[model samples]
Target chain A: MNGDLTVSAASKDTLPTVFGYIGIGVAFGIVGKAAGLSPLLVTLMSIITYAGSAQFVIVSMLVTHSPIFSIIFSVFLVNSRMILMSTTLASYFKRESMVKNILVGTLLTDESFALGMNKLNYSDNHLNFAWFNTANVISYMTWILSSLVGAVLGNFISNPEKFGLDFALVAMFIGLLYLQLISDKSINFNLQLIVVGFVLVAIYFGLIFIPSSLLILLVTLVACSFGVVMKHAFF
Target chain B: MPSFNFVLLTIVGTGVVTWLSRITPFVLLKKFQLSKGVVEFLSFVPIAIMSALWFENLFVQHIGHLPSIDWANLLASLPTVLSAVISKNLLVIVVVGVISLGVTRLMMGM
Candidate 1:
């Protein structure tokens, strides 16, 4: 080995993710702490679950005293996209050992997976487990630390809602929803918006008619089907 | 403080389910193939879920009555959605949304 430090392409694109995770992580922490969770629990969530939106949903659910099974279902639904990511990654990991696949899979995230896939498709980066895991670990540690910072910061705020900390989750979702809309270049902007508008209206009515715990899952399923059907019908 | 067990279970349970979903495709889906239709449908899940979550929190619902907008959040959403569109950055959008909401709440004498 030359002993010269070389930044793997897998890790190079992680700078944006570092900043992204910290902001979201801290927001999650403040929101969690605002909901009466211990700072330690907030940090543990960052360390363990590591999914941003899902964590927010879980915290809000906990505040409402939702059933435990319902909370788990929310996690599963929010994170089901990981299945698609893992499926795409499986092709790349075929030659690697099962142990490596297992370990790497555990660390898979939207940013890291996107980085690895983008590099594989266009760049010359050698995506070894070391490089891949390095990306995940960096964000992983950053998330936990940022969440702790927010949790500690949250202690000083007498009323989170007054400070708009409660709106943080909703704001984050709005941002994320926009991100999702643009992330997939395959789908045109207009079409995605139509679907979003449809889903929003459905959820509004669904909230009134159906049990929310059940409505969320059903709406997601129905909306996706509607999107697929519309996509085929249009394009 | 919430019951220690409930908090622990939620965290651990979510972590398990999340990790399992991340790894399941590697160990199990390797042998099978997902149809293109299924993948397309899956792509829409995030959009649908995010929209649902956003709308759910944006309004205050009443049984047998249409949900009314939470004016504070709705007003705050003006800037939030704008920053999200203009900057297209999560951190920026969040900062804008938080500051805007905080200001709105203050000005409204909330």
Candidate 2:
């Protein structure tokens, strides 16, 4: 009975995270179409690319008729973060079979990482691999299908911009960030405020010196390192 | 440069890069264990990167000038943020943000 209850509770926590990926996936699809990519191309990108920010950047480049080499470089730069994500997972997956590890690595995304990391927190077992794979598959299917739907129907809609569908992506990220904020409730409000201020400053400066993707990486690393150092020093 | 060839090259190029970024770490780390400090630093990378990305989108202009305060993006972001705070469900927040932006744009004669 206790085992069953635990399983049920775990599923409850994970189910919403899975569904969130679906919604995010759909939003990506809609936005991809608005950016002028074809449905087939959008689907292929979702399947092949899997990283949301990279996909968005790719579509933006496509709409602007960027050269092929530029698009490739931009995608490479945007996805550089995945190297960190996969590396972290490597430590936890030391015991898993090679095939399983490769499959999971291919499906790694922010949502999948969150779910997998949360599960890893509770158990020392390898079964978290299965859960991670399951969540990724669910998220992947939702993203692909929703993107296909958006691509096919996107043309009929005369004005997606008017409806503010573009804001969907922003709102989704905000919601995800809110969750991160709440999880670390002990964080000082004053420090949080300062971090926000610094991010804005970074954004202003980042626009001048670097591409948006790299700017994000640079600011995040600097700010987060500061936050971590402060936390250790003070608390 | 045929379109079909362009598509094929994109797929292959992206695939190769993606696979290498993901696979290389595992292969290298398999032989050597990561130090505690390294692990701790890596754990924070995602949150930092995501924040930077989100902040950039919220503030930067995609096309010409930064979108005006009167732009659909600014007008729509208001409701979208509200919906996210209230619902906390991805679908609800997305639908609300998109629909609200659309309706507001129509009303504003944009």
Candidate 3:
């Protein structure tokens, strides 16, 4: 332990995540507050759930007074990717104690998971629970605080798009995809990934009745299968 | 407005379900040994999920409806994607995207 002062790898690695979370969190807060949710409630949801897309679903479903069970189910389906993420991450942890895994898993979100996995996939860094936990805590605080700010200032901003915050996450994901694609040496062109992704996108467009969350899950499943099947068939 | 109790239940219920999804894999993987084929299949999940999310944001306006050629998003994304491919820096990509989107919105009087 550092008797003086030192920055951990988790904190350093999560700096980008802090920025990403803040943008999305404020957007969530503004939308929640605009939908008539109390600021305190919005903040509490951020603290407790800490899931970005699911929180948005909660706010919309609340406005419509959708059935509670259905809301939970939708959130579960949307977040099912967390399972795959955690599975991928489990191999990186130095020691996976029950308590450590529980605490670390509690803080898992898509962005942090993606960033951490990218680091693990490309580099030889020794990822520990402390690193993942630190990223988690920083990201958690960023989201809660930003969402609170958004909720408090929700009345002041009528159109979030005027500031161009709406496109923030899309830009972040594009950057991430680029990073992942360049790091891999085996594959030159992502023709297979792009083809599979576009095919699923077309299906999603055609089947409007299916829930987007469920559609994402199905797309992932089918695409992975297709990728594996093609790999087996050709090579 | 819905009662406080109802909102609380919704939030708590949501938190529980979400946490369960996050935790279940870590807990269960301790006991189970996944097959080699399964791991290989799982490797592609990240790219798949990321692409699905990116397309959803770009091509879909509402959850159920197709986007009617979101010119602003499209135009902004061009430079943004170019920056990502060329610079490969997160900050640069994000800045280019936001500035481009802002400029497009201004030019279109959005």
A106-165: candidate 1 lDDT, tens digit per residue: 988766665454344233323566667777788788878988998998887544456665
Provide the DockQ value for model 2. Answer: 0.43
Clashing pairs in 2: A162-B102, A163-B101, A163-B102
- Candidates 1 and 2 compared: the better one by TM-score is 2
lDDT tens per residue, model 2, A1-235 = 0112144444454455544455456666777677766677778877876666677676776667678787778777777767877887887777877777888788777666654544443454233456666666776777788778777777775454554655555555555555544443346655555565676666666676566666665776677676667656775
By DockQ, the candidates rank as 3, 1, 2
- Model 2 docking grade: acceptable
Q: Sort by TM-score, best first.
A: 3, 2, 1
Instruction: Calculate candidate 3's fnat.
Output: 0.58
lDDT of 3 by residue, A1-235 (tens): 1111124755666675566677778888899989998999999999887789889988888889899899889888988878878887766552668788878788898777767656654455346676678778898999999999999889898567787776777777777776766664433346455544664565456446566777777777777777777667764
At residue A141, give the lDDT of candidate 3. Answer: 90
Q: Candidate 2: which stretches are off by over 4 Å?
A: A1-38, A60-65, A115-127, A185-197, B62-109
lDDT of 3 at A223: 76
Model 1 chain A lowest lDDT segment of ten: A1-10
On residues B5-103, what C-alpha lDDT tens digit does candidate 3 reach at each position? 888888899899889888888877766777888887876766776667666665544555654466788788899899998887777787787788889
Error of 2 at A97 (Å): 2.7
- Candidate 3's C-alpha runs over 4 A off are A1-7, A186-209, B61-67
